[model samples]
Target: MLVTLREILEQAEQGNFAVGSFNSPTLESVRAVTEAAEELQSPIILSHAEVHNDIIPIEIIGPIFIQFAKQASVPVVVHLDHGSNLNIIKKAIDIGFTSVMIDASHMEYEDNIRIVQEVVDYAHKHNVSVEAELGMMTSSGIGGEETQGGEHHATQEAEDYYTDPLIAKDFVQKTEIDALAASFGTVHGIYVQEPNLDIKRLKAIYENIGRPVVMHGGSGLEIEDYVNVIQSGVRKINYYSYAAKAGAQAVKEYIQQNQNLFYHDYTVVAKQAIKEDVKRAMKIFMNNGY
Candidate 1:
């Protein structure tokens, strides 16, 4: 069933498990995640960023994701991830997204609050949940195009953009967001090496902010790191790179093994491969049952 983000995150917080928020760029990716959730009896969130929409187009994938959410046996929340513009956020809300994120963390604190407040007001009116980001995440070392109309930045400098605990508290209280994505020590995209997560800082934010916190850039973390972070107060974990890698690797292996296989036949192999990967992630997330 399609459910609100507040309900999902609250359940995750109370149960001491982080909900897996998977990013899907295609129908196969969406199928893998929803099927995994149903098979495992775990609640999950299907997330897509506006940046991705630039490639796949929201009008094409939005309805498909919503349909999958409604058909899932377990509660599933269709969410907009890292939404940089109010226009896109509004479109998600209008299209029946259960949750929308207003990521204005790159802006000044006051401006961030103002933008989030606008989203919260609009989302709440439609009985949807809103998530706001406190810090910015960027690719490490490599300079990538800014997806949300911001300057190019590096993940190594993310510590400078880390969310202030006090400012986070004030931002949440002022904007009335249902959840806040706090940047402890994670960045968007794959890490060049093992990333050192700031667990102590995350604990402080969880203890001080008094709301469910989200951790993005979950693809490269060690299992122990993920467990420790979730225990500390990361109620929602967003993943993208791992799934993409799994899908691509599966198709490559299939082609290499079967030299005569047609390109059209590869979709089935890719789907099964990604499905298994999603299930593995769901198990690691430990969100099964309750």
Candidate 2:
């Protein structure tokens, strides 16, 4: 059934497990994630990043996502990821997105709160949930263009971008956001160095803010780290990069194995590979000895 982000995240918090917020920009991805969630009986979030407007225009994909959510057997949240402007966010909301993210972390602190507050007010009136980013992260994954690159920045310098626990509390209070995406040690795409999450800082943010904490750049982490982050208070995890990579690799392998395959055959291979990858992710998020 279609649900809001708040409802899903609240369930995640109670169960002490993170929900896989998969970036479902393509039809194959939407199918893979929704099917995987239903099979696992897991509440999943299907997200479309605003930056992917070129890949598939939101106008075309928005309603398709809503329809998929409504048809899914398990709870589903159709969310707008990394909505950099209010105009795009508003458009997603108008298109029936259950949740919208206002990513103003790159702006000044006061400006970030102001913009997020405006979005929260508007989104809440429509019975939608609002998520806001509090700290900056490297742009290395899909929808990562025009942002700071992780390869160009050193791992040690990442601490400079980590979210302040106290400030996160204040920002959530001022913006009245339903969820907070805070950066402690993860980047958007792949990790240049080993993935290390600041569990202490994450716990502090969760305790101070008293709301569901979201972790962007959720791909590329070890299974142990995924469990640790959930235990430390991460309720929503935005994962992509690797799952998409798996699908791309599957297509290449299929073409290599078969001399003459139709376009539909390739889509079948890609969709199945992505579905399996999503299922693995959902099991890990279950945090139930999977």
Candidate 3:
């Protein structure tokens, strides 16, 4: 069953469980995630980031994602994660994406709003859901051509780096985004240190925003943290880097252990590794199917 973010998340808000948004780095990863979701009978999201287009172009992968979402037994949302290009956003919608994130988190506040509002207006007209981020989300210094060579801007003031509840209210009202990806203390990629979530801040945003709260940078958080944030009212969570790493490492280990295995055989092992990891994530998130 193909479903929108709003369709899946309204149930999450009522049931108090977070839906895992796993990024599809390859068509294989999407296949793995879909299998896991069907086996668990859980509603799942498959995402492809704008930054990863160099590795897996959205146009090449969007149709496959749409096909998987439509054919899946459990609910699925085909989402474009961290969309920076409006043209790509429009293309993904035309390619049949159920949801998109018009990420202008790096832009100035009003500029971010302007960019997101334009996307929302266009996406809404086509009946597609939109997600927009507020505040600055930091990186744990991993992934991509752009960031691989640069130093990560560490959080000097936690509040300065994270979303403000007041601005969240206004951002939602102005952008009309279906979901808000709120940055608390979590950063993208792997955790460089002990990850501590600002549960109070998450609670404050939930109390004020009156919209589905999304937790990105969810790869390294402790299981308890997922429980805390979902309870604090986060309906959707993004998990990617961990799955990417798991599949790669699994293939590497498999090939090394079985030196005679064919090159194509690695993909077979990789999909299973990705599938099991995705299933574990879905279980950890505890989706009680609505």
RMSD per model, one decimal:
2.2, 2.2, 2.2
List candidate 1 stretches off by more than 4 Å: 141-152, 155-157, 287-290
By lDDT, the best candidate is 2
Candidate 3 versus the native: TM-score? 0.94
Q: Write the per-residue lDDT of candidate 1 for residues 170-265, one digit (tens) a residue.
A: 888899888889877776665776787888888888887788999877776888888888888888988877677778888998878886878667
Every model's TM-score:
0.94, 0.95, 0.94
What's the CA error at residue 89 for candidate 2, in Å? 0.7
Model 2 Cα lDDT, one tens digit per residue, 119-152: 9999999999999988787654343333431122
Model 1 error, position 40 (Å): 0.6
lDDT of 2: 0.86
Q: After superposition, how far is residue 241 of candidate 1 from its true place, in Å?
A: 0.4
lDDT of 3 at 154: 65
* Consecutive 10-residue window with the lowest summed lDDT within model 2: 143-152
lDDT of each: 0.82, 0.86, 0.85
lDDT of 3 by residue, 1-290 (tens): 88898889888887888899988878788889999999988899989888788888998888989889899999999999888889999999999999999888888889999999999999999889999998877777774213421123564765677889998999999988899999888777877788778999999998988999998888777778887888898899898878877888999899778858786788888899989888888998884333
Residue pairs in candidate 3 whose N, alpha carbon or C atoms collide under 3 angstroms: none
